[model samples]
Target: MKLINWWPPMLGTGISLKKVSKDMTTFEVIMKLRWYNRNLVGIHYGGSLYSMCDPWYMFILMANLGKGYVVMDKAAAIRYKKPGRGTLKCVFHISKSEIKEIRSEIDMIGKKDYTFTCEVMDEEGEVVTEVDKVVYVRKKDFDFEALEKEKEAGNTKIPG
Candidate 1:
């Protein structure tokens, strides 16, 4: 499914895409804390905090890169800076130059992997969570026929 469709699930969990630019390279998504989203201490649940961070950067990259390339959130490491009490917002931004630089690096290295960083900030504009995300990108020349066959045979699960 398209990435935009994910908005529903995010919203269902109190996350809202407040603003998405026309280019869709930068976006502001907010997650409000409801009673259900609170932990025993009545702060934002850690799992929900992590969940709110789940998709912004990857979506930004995909929308910026168009279609020839594929981007995935291969791995993520989040460092929570402080307790979240009120509403939370994560602003994700990817520029053309950044995307171009990534492409150039991949072209020079052939099929390989790369990583980028994104941050989720609180109302104070302080980073509440810092995320290090790794993305595995491969070129069309890379041998994938066998892998595709395996996927067709239900032996592999490729990231969408």
Candidate 2:
């Protein structure tokens, strides 16, 4: 988590992780409009807004679903609604029931793709950007438990 906190792109864009729930179901991120991150007109950069939102969904799903699943960020799109002049915050949340639903869908289809929407808001709570993220999830074919046991025993090589 500390590694993520100091991640170069996030740091460069002035995006900070405020909180992450113990279960990884919720994450809060804030981006301050600093001199370095501001565009020529002194507003937040569009790329910065998108970077602020890039990773949370996949991170949350991976943590919640554990090693038995493969989770990836399949696609994303961001729409700039207004110029962000100050601090902007975005919260990402995925409920246990949602996780259950995803699992059910994956079990039924062998894979599932889900779209999540998030709104980035300014300090005054006006929407600054809208982001849509599509994540892909599927159960892994290998035995995760055995892999964990092997790693714990200091056997790094995978059996062919």
Candidate 3:
């Protein structure tokens, strides 16, 4: 939370993660409609709304799936349902059972693309944006121990 609060893109756009569950399966991000983050028409910028929804599912998957799997966002789509105003929030959550299902599917198929949908809402709880993210997960064939050693040696970076 401390490190991510300083993330440049989020900080620049006024988007901030408000809270995260202890297990990292649930979190909330919020953005207040400010001069810098508004669209020309005086609503939340599409990019900011989308940004609040991005990367979260992948982050959750990576946390739950361990080091033996690859998790990345494969694609995404966003729709502006209504003009957002004031403080807008997006709540991200995926159940443990759902994660287990995804793992089971990946174990059987070797890889899978899982799509999850979430909404960005206004203070009144009316949806302002709808986003569907496709996350890709696959088993890794490489040695996790070797990767860890390389990471400790400061010589390798893993891609999400």
Q: Which candidate comes out best when scored by lDDT?
A: 2
lDDT of 1 by residue, 32-140 (tens): 8898788998887877777776777777767766576667778877788888878888877778787777676554444455666777777788877777777776555
Task: Determine which window of 10 residues in candidate 2 has minimal summed lDDT.
Answer: 103-112
Clashes of each: 0, 0, 0
* Residue 58 lDDT in candidate 1: 75
For each candidate in the order shown, give its overall lDDT on alpha carbons. 0.71, 0.88, 0.87
User: Per-residue alpha-carbon lDDT of model 3 for 1-160, expressed as tens digits?
Assistant: 6468689888988988889888889988999999999999998888988888898899899998999899999999999898999999998899999998888766644677889999998999999999999999997864557656778998864433
Q: Which residue pairs clash within candidate 2?
A: none
Least accurate 10 contiguous residues by lDDT in model 3: 141-150
RMSD, every candidate, angstroms: 7.9, 9.2, 8.9
lDDT (C-alpha) at residue 136 in model 2: 92
- The stretch of ten residues in a row with the least summed lDDT in candidate 1 is 105-114
Q: Residue 115 lDDT in model 2?
A: 95
- Per-residue lDDT of candidate 2, residues 1-160 (tens digit): 7468788998899999999888889999999989999999999999999998999999999988888889999999999998998999999999999998787666544566889999999999999999999999988874556657767998755322
Give candidate 2's error at residue 125 in angstroms: 0.7
